[model samples]
Each structure stands twice: as structure tokens, then as C-alpha cells.
Target: MGFSPDSFYIKTLGLTNTDDAEIWEYATTNDFVIVSKDSDFHQRSLLYGHPPKFIYLRVGNCSTSKIVQVLQDEIDIISQFGDREAESILVLS
Candidate 1:
């Protein structure tokens, strides 16, 4: 993976000029889900409403590898549980 720590928490799979709000917008627009450790994103998800999907990690202090593994473990279930009205967070432990 070419992901840096900054890229891990920040949006990286889209257009170069995209901002945070724009990233969120694009995710929804293109059905691309987000996996983030930032609580702010969870807040924004609620404040702005749902995109295609999102995973908000609440797990405390872990290395990037650990975080990636945790997310990979949950990837299959994400789409199964996806719904705009019912989901806004995905606290990984």
C-alpha cells in the first residue's frame, strides 16, 4: 500500500483539488465508502447526511497496520449493514 499516515485518515482516492467537504460529497456521489479514524468525520456524516457508506473508528491508539487489518476484517460486513437512515458510525476496536 502506498498510503502514508496523512493519506490514511485523509481522502486519497479522488480528484486532487477535493477538500474535506468535497471528499464527502464525492463519496456520496460515486458510491465510494470512507474508512477513517477521525471522530470529526463521524460528526460531519451526521451533520451533512449519509453518503454511499462510511466507517468511523473509535478504537484508541493503534499502528497503521493494525488499523488497516481491523478495517479489512470488517470490509465484508460493511456493505451488508449499509443504510443511510440507520448508520453513521462504525467504531472499530
Candidate 2:
């Protein structure tokens, strides 16, 4: 549903069901960084401008653990740039 900011972790919002736009809005409202495999998120970010922050993984392919670690590794770095009024995007590969 949602994740704790301390965790900087994703609470899988589900799949084959939830719409990307809804998820995007949810992330913005909840102040949760989206950790998704879909490239659509990036496209949407550009189209709608941006939220406080976003993380888009451009890795071709990888294990879930690897993806999670990538996010974990950058949590602090990204957080430093996070601001409610300042939208941002962090791309990791």
C-alpha cells in the first residue's frame, strides 16, 4: 500500500491491475519514491513535469535483490535532494 520513509522501501502496490497514473499520483501524495521496473514511469515523469522525487532504474535486467540494493545504496544521496516543492528524478542503472 505505502512505505515508511525510514525504510525507503517499496510496498509493492500490486500489478496487472493498478494504473500507472494512479501509482504516480500516489507516490507524489505519499512522498514515497517509486521503485519500478517499468520505463513508463520515466516517460510520465517527463510528461507531467515531476513530483518531489522519483527513482527510475534503467538497468537492462537484474534480480529483485540487486534492484533493491541499488535503491538502498542511493537512499541517502537522493534524500539529500528531496524537497516537497522541488520535483526531481534519479535514474539508476
Candidate 3:
């Protein structure tokens, strides 16, 4: 299944410039997965555990379409990750 950008992306939420801590809290409260390249989210997930699971991308800077393609390639794994209650951090290379 394709991910919906209007419902899932930070830019769509008018939060592109928002602080990370607030973004973390918002995701936690909203039952949304946080997709980011920033290592800070990975570190935070490690420290605080779940509620808002994080997907960390190690692809460096890339086009939006490239990011989507990477995510699509891992959709199965991501779906599995969502079903497991214990997994809090998903690292995508």
C-alpha cells in the first residue's frame, strides 16, 4: 500500500520548521510514525521507547521521489514492523 503524504508528512502538518521535541510529542499523541533522517529521533526512540515508532533513513540527502521509492521498497518490512508491538525503531538504509 502506498503511504499517503497528505496524512503522514511533516510538511503537510505545517510543522516543517517546528522543534523536534514538539514533533516527537505530537507524533506520540497522534499515533503517527515519525519518518526522519535526523539521528536525534533514533536516539530519542532508543531512550524513551515507543508509542510513536520512528523510521530512520540513512539515505543522506535525496529527492522526495527517491525517498518514496526507498520506502516503497521496504513496505513489507515496514508493515511487519507496524504489526509488532515491541519494535520501536526501524532503520532503513
Candidate 2: pairs in clash: none
Task: Pick the winner on TM-score between candidates 1 and 2.
Answer: 2
Off by more than 4 A, model 1:
2-18, 83-86
RMSD of each: 4.7, 3.6, 2.2
TM-score of 3: 0.90
Clashing pairs in 3: none
Candidate 1 RMSD computed on C-alpha atoms after optimal superposition onto the true structure: 4.7
- Candidate 2's C-alpha runs over 4 A off are 1-16, 83-87
Model 3: runs farther than 4 Å from truth? 5-7
Pairwise TM-score winner, candidates 1 and 3: 3
Clashes of each: 0, 0, 0
What lDDT does each candidate get? 0.65, 0.66, 0.88
TM-score of each: 0.66, 0.71, 0.90
Residue range 1-93, candidate 2, lDDT tens digits:
122345443334443476888777777797766666688887887777667356778877887677767767776766675643565667777
Top-TM-score structure, candidate number: 3
The digit string of per-residue lDDT tens for model 1 on 13-86 reads 63665666777877777776677776767878778656646677777888877877776677666646664357
Best by lDDT: 3
